[model samples]
Every structure is written in C-alpha cells, then in structure tokens.
Target: MAAQGDKHKSISGLTPHEFITLNELEQIPEGFLAEHSANQMEYNDAKKKFAEICEDYGKILENGKKSQALEFAFKVIYDIEPEARSIKKVKQDKMWNFIFSSKGNDGESKRKICWIHTDKAVFKHSTNPKEIILTVKLASLLAIETWKMLIEHAQFMKIDKVLLTPSAGAIYSLKDIRFIAARIEGNQRNTTNIQKIINASCQPGGHLLAESNYSCALAAVLASTKDMKNEEVRVQIVSKVVKQYFVARKPLDVDKCRIWCQFAFDGNYRMLNNSDNDVLHKIFKYAQKNAQIIKLREVEF
Candidate 1:
C-alpha cells in the first residue's frame, strides 16, 4: 500500500496477495480501491456467505466439502495489490470459532486451540492491528502438541491450583482476554533440530511484527482458560495450554483433532523453502496425520 507510482505491478499489487484483514482494506487508496473493488466485493460477498454458514454449523470443511470454498479463499486477494514487501501485514485465520454461553454452564469444554507459527508475538492486548497470528495445517498440529507442552510447563510454574469456570468454557472473546507479551517466555528450547522446528511452529502474542511471507500461518482452535472464581484470567494461550497439558495430559486423538479452516494468504505462504517444508511435513506426520489437508478439499463453510 505504499504511495508509489500506479504503474509498477504484478497481476495484483502485492506479490502473492494479502489476507485483506480489516486494517489492510482500510489502508487502501480510494482510487485503487475503486478500480479493483468489484473483484474485492465479489470475494467479500463470498466471505460473508461463508461466515453465515460457519455460524449455522459447528465446523467448516466438515465431511470433506472444502474444495470449492478453499479455492475462493486461496486467491491472490486483489489483483492490484503490490508485493506487500513494504506494507506490514497483520492477519488472523480463525481456524475455529467459540460458541459462548451468556450464563455459565458446567457442560462447556475447553476452547479449541489454533496455534500459529509466529515470527514474533504480543502476549498482551494492543489495538495495534500489526499483531500478526496465523497458522496452516502443519502449524495446527504443532499447536496441539505445543498446547500439551504448555500445560506441562505451566503446572510446574503457576495455575495448577486454579479452578475451572462454570460456563460451557467460552474461549473468552479476544477483547476480554489479556494477551501476555513475550516477556518471560518459555525458552522453547529444544535439543534436536526436529524439536526446534516443531517448537518454533507454536506461539500466541503482543504487538507482533509481520511481513507477507511464508511463516506458517494457522489458527484452527479458539484456546483459553479460566480460574475457580469463574473469571477470565490473563494467561498466555501457550501458558494456558501449558496448564491444560498437565490436567489433560492425555495423547491427542489425531483422528478427533480436526481443523476446518484453510487460510492461504495470497499464495505467498506456498513459497516456503523446500527444506523447511520437508522438516515441517515430517514434524506434522508425527502428529497431524491428516497433514495433506493443505491441498484443496471440498469444504463447507
């Protein structure tokens, strides 16, 4: 979105495209927006329809109806966007949604987690739209594993004595939960290269910096935790995952763990280095057996 000349271009403005978050869309120039807005409108309409369907159903891409929906979502966003190298992009891929219950209900289960492989993170709250969080099929699996680890580590730290909430465990809307910045972060230290790669694939953050490149963008679950007094305490998703891992230190049922969302940011993420991708694929094989979920599927959302 830099104010460069109107001539330098690709099929779109940015190479690969943007996820077109609300912030990015707002930053677009009036002239550029009007020129390419029709296509954007079409996509927006499709997104709205998809949102409505997601509202009705508990999950998207259920029973393998993801092909059509994913095709539309995997475009170069708008054809006029530039290489976005100059414009910092902040995006979120809602791999899963939380169903909130106004009155607390004991029946609620833990919120589904969608872990993104962020380059940096903001564990606390900020109106900074540049706080980037993303995930892909591989990252989601890593996220689950990361969550398991979080609960484990956190138990050794604090929150082991915390009580469960009374509601059908709402994922506490983004506005209510306090995001802990990466101040006293877990070392994410690993002994082997594989462990290192997998560990890097997980995080939930504050004023996160962003670039429109391959950093494994994924967010499949809405993760959160509560205290005994039925109040939403500010716990990092990773830390809360840390606490939960101890409480529910069971193995993840890979078959039961499903992510219905596939947010491809203008095909740029596909440009991941082959070596990194190979390592990631191997890591995912150890967890998300449905690792091939990235390719187009018949999703219903």
Candidate 2:
C-alpha cells in the first residue's frame, strides 16, 4: 500500500478512496496470517490452473471455435470458486460463501457481463442483487475472460457499491480494490495504445495503488469499530498509511500526488474551484511533515 500510494499519486491527480488490508486491522491478531496461510496456498493453486485453461480456450475462440468456447467457459466456472467440500467428520462443515455468483435471469447475467462483446442480448432490468453479485463474481474469476470482465466493471461496480449493502458483497474492500489496480496495470502493459490505457484508467477509483493483499485488514478494522464516533481517528489511521506509502515511494510525481490527495481528502474540503493542483500540493506537503504513528481511540486492550 505504501509503495502503490506513492506511485499511484505520482502518475494521477487522485488517490484511492478505498483500500485497507486485513493485516492492518488493529484488533486482529497477526496469527490470523497463519490460519489463512493454507487457504492462500489453495487459492494460488486454483489461480494457476484456471489461467492455463483460459489460455487454451482463448486460442480456440480466436479460431472461431464457438463450440469449444462454451465448453471451456463451463469448466472454468466449476474450477474457480466451486462449492465448498463437505466433511463427514466435521459438524461445522459448511460452504464458504462465494464472493460472486451467476445462476439467475439471463438478462441479469448479460448486465453483469456488460463489458464483454456477446451475441446474446437481454432487454430487462435487473432486480436481483444476489444474482448480480454471483454473476459478477463468476465473471471475475482468474481466467482471461473473467479478468476482462473485472477490468471493465471494477470502477463501475465501485461506484455502484454505494447503493448496495455489504451483505451482497457490494462493499469496496481490499481484494476488489486491488484487483482494479492490478488488472488496469496489467492491461496497460500489454496493450499498445497508450490512449486506450489512459481512458480505461481514468475510470472511477483507478487512482488506487495498493495491492489486493491489503483489503482484508481494512475490512476487519471497519467491522470491529462500526459504532465509533471519532472521524479524526479514522483520518489519522488513513493518513498514517498514506504517509508510509509516500515515504517509501518518495518524491511522488505531481500527478500522483494529486490523485492521492483526492482519495484521502475527497470530501474534506468543498470543491469550489478547478484549482486542484494548488489544493493537493498543500495536502501532500502537510503529509510529508506529519507522518506519525496514529493510535486508535477505541482499543480493546
């Protein structure tokens, strides 16, 4: 996060509005890392296997292999984020909830995959958040097609999260946030047109730089202190993260500093004028001198 924040604000005149990893949550024990270590390993294995399948299928699709493309798509779904396994010995055996699903109205499915070029079309409005989330989640798996969907929809979805509750996976957290940044960087690196990359990046929340690993920590903190009345504490915590990021990636470019300032102070001041450069310079200057550790007000210890 520290590294990305520096690089992020250097290139763009905006900072990320959302990004907090599970590790950074004050109350959560560091040992939670040990617990998820196994799950992380499994996820990595699944990601690698899914990538290979997508590559082969991509070749077939390019050759007008419609029949094969559908077949590969189905297989990819089963492989990526499949239903949890049941253990006979474990009474607590239950399916870990999927971050997204795709088993509902065809129209909803199409809307969830709005970015993709497809022949199938739907002319109905979507009313199902559950199905929308599931469909979006399935379309955002590790495969190329899924990754494409993720890149196209991430910003739009981030904006949409303001309308939906956390229960539907609409909250803007670490994994979703980092996925946006990483996928954008990936696309920019591979594509030849610098204009296209810039246009795509300029979408909502494209200015965030931290990696996905930071999401869980941020979400945990928000969950632990939902009733706190101290906005300053929250601001301080966020400032600490931003300061560390800039210090590590020192002397941010003019544009990057602007973006980071926007993300950090998006609503701190009323936007009355177009003079953002002047405003951001002052904010970053303050951050540079006051990069100090912040202690939360509502600590459990």
Candidate 3:
C-alpha cells in the first residue's frame, strides 16, 4: 500500500505524495465504500491490470508520470476522481438582436449581441455572460444529483474516464467535518453545492432545523450524496437522522446544528465577505421568533 502520510514512502518503490493530496481526503463521496465493497473482485482485477499497465509502460517509477491508460486503470480499480486532470472545454458563439418599431414595415431593426463559450456543454445556448451565470446557478441547484451521478460514474466507468486524486478516494476524505467546513470557508463563489446543502439544512423544519449545531448539515449532505439520488437510501437516511435527532435531546448535541451555525454564523460572515453584524442581527431576529414560540407554551396555566 502507498504510505499514508510520508511522501517518501513507496508504492512499488514510488512515493504516493508525488501524485495525491497530502491530507484533503475528506471531501469525497460516501458511496465509495459500497462501490469498493461490491466491486471488490473487479477492483482486484483492475488493480492487477493497473500494476501491469504501470510495469509495461515503465512509468510506475516516476510518481508524477501519467497517461490515459494509467489514469483509467486507477479510476477503474480505485474508483477515485481526481480534479487535476485537464480536459478540453466546450465553446460556442451567439448573437442577440433587438428591434424598436413605430411604423409599419418601414422601421429598421436594431440588434445587440455578444459571442461566448465555456467548458460545460449542458448550457449550449448560454452565450450571454449573465445567462451563463444563471445557467450555472440553476444547474448547480441540481448539483446534489449531478454530484451523486459523478460519484457513481467514477465507480462504474459508466461515462468517460474521470481523473482523481489518490487521496484515499473522495468521500472518505470529506467525512472530516473540519475539512468540509474549511472548504465552505475558503470558497470564493457566493453560491455552491456545499452552500446549498447548508442552506437546506437551516431552513425551518428543513433537513437540519437546529439552533446551534453543525452535524445535520454534514449528515444531510453525506446522506444526499451517498447514492446517485437522495432517494436511494431515503428510508435508511431518514431513520438514521431521526434516530440521531431524538437521541441527542439537546439540539446542540446534534452535529447538524453545528454545521448549520458554522455556515450560517461563520461561513457567511467570515468566508463570504458578508456583513457579520447584519447576519448576527438577522440570526438574533430568528432566535427571537423561536423564543416567542417557546414562551407560548405556558398559556394554559
């Protein structure tokens, strides 16, 4: 096995750190475990194929050396998707036209347009920069599902080969809450799948519905992405969440509550450049609402 931390450790006499993340393994998907388990036989076969490919290519000795075949073998055998691999981006050009009319058949039509292109093909017609941003936003709302599919694809080779960091698979690394929390903190874009998951967990009666917790958001994101659909293991997820919810008694004991606060109180203000005082004020308002609800409990006395 490739040595865990020491970059000097050898994989067939090659250091693993030359190609994989040193410690960011917690950002991967949860389905990796099941895929690894179900495909153990295939995984072993693929591992053998990978070793053969490495040996035949005479490239295993150079930890940084890479090729499609080698990459494919690692993806196939280990089911990891590294983001470092580069791929050609899709591109397109478009124009827009506008017309102002005051007379019949005699007015000249005015037009305004711009040409653009991008890496993702899902939004083929999104040529306007604003439109492209909107497309990404809308499409990203569907990220939970897309990410799930991506995770699954990495497992089965159902799609083209995906690159991966040799960081003990993606999901396993992401399980560390602190790491996910940091990603939330470091992200530049105001909106992201992680943010969405956090938001979902914070809404009233939302997946999280906690006052000062963080675990539910983590659990929800984990559960949602555990399979290709948030529904695959719905029963188990719900049961597990509900079980944990009641078992904790105090909402603070729930990890979900902390996840909510981390993003809500810390991530928004500290990471996203939002006004801390404003966010805190809003949070206080929400707290007052909760307090009001609790105050009404003694009316029958």
Q: Provide the lDDT at 17 for model 2.
A: 20
Query: Residue 107 deviation, candidate 2, in Å?
Result: 32
For model 3, residues 1-301, the per-residue Cα lDDT tens digits are 1112111211232122222332121111345333333333332333333233233222322334333323223322232112111211223222211111112255753222211111222233333322222122122222222222233333343322222223212322233334454544554322233433443342222322222123433333333333435443543443333323323232322333334334333233223123322322343343344432121111111
- Please write out the lDDT profile of model 2 over residues 1-301, one tens digit for every residue: 0011011101011111211011022222334333334333443444443333223322322222232223333333333223211122333222111122123355453112111111112212235422211121323233323223323333433432211112212223223333333433444222222222222222111112122212222222333333457855654544333333333232334443332223223223222234334333444455445443212222211
Cα lDDT, model 2, residue 152? 32
Q: On a 0 to 1 TM-score scale, where does candidate 1 land against the true structure?
A: 0.16
Model 2: per-residue Cα lDDT at residue 301: 19
Q: Report how far off residue 61 is in candidate 2 (Å).
A: 7.8
- RMSD in angstroms, all models? 24.0, 17.7, 22.2
Whole-model lDDT values for every prediction: 0.23, 0.28, 0.29
Q: What is the lDDT for 154 in model 1?
A: 33
Worst 10 residues of 1 by lDDT: 205-214
The Cα RMSD of model 1 versus the native structure comes to 24.0
Worst 10 residues of 2 by lDDT: 1-10
**Which regions of candidate 3 fall more than 4 Å away from where they truly are?**
1-38, 53-233, 236-301
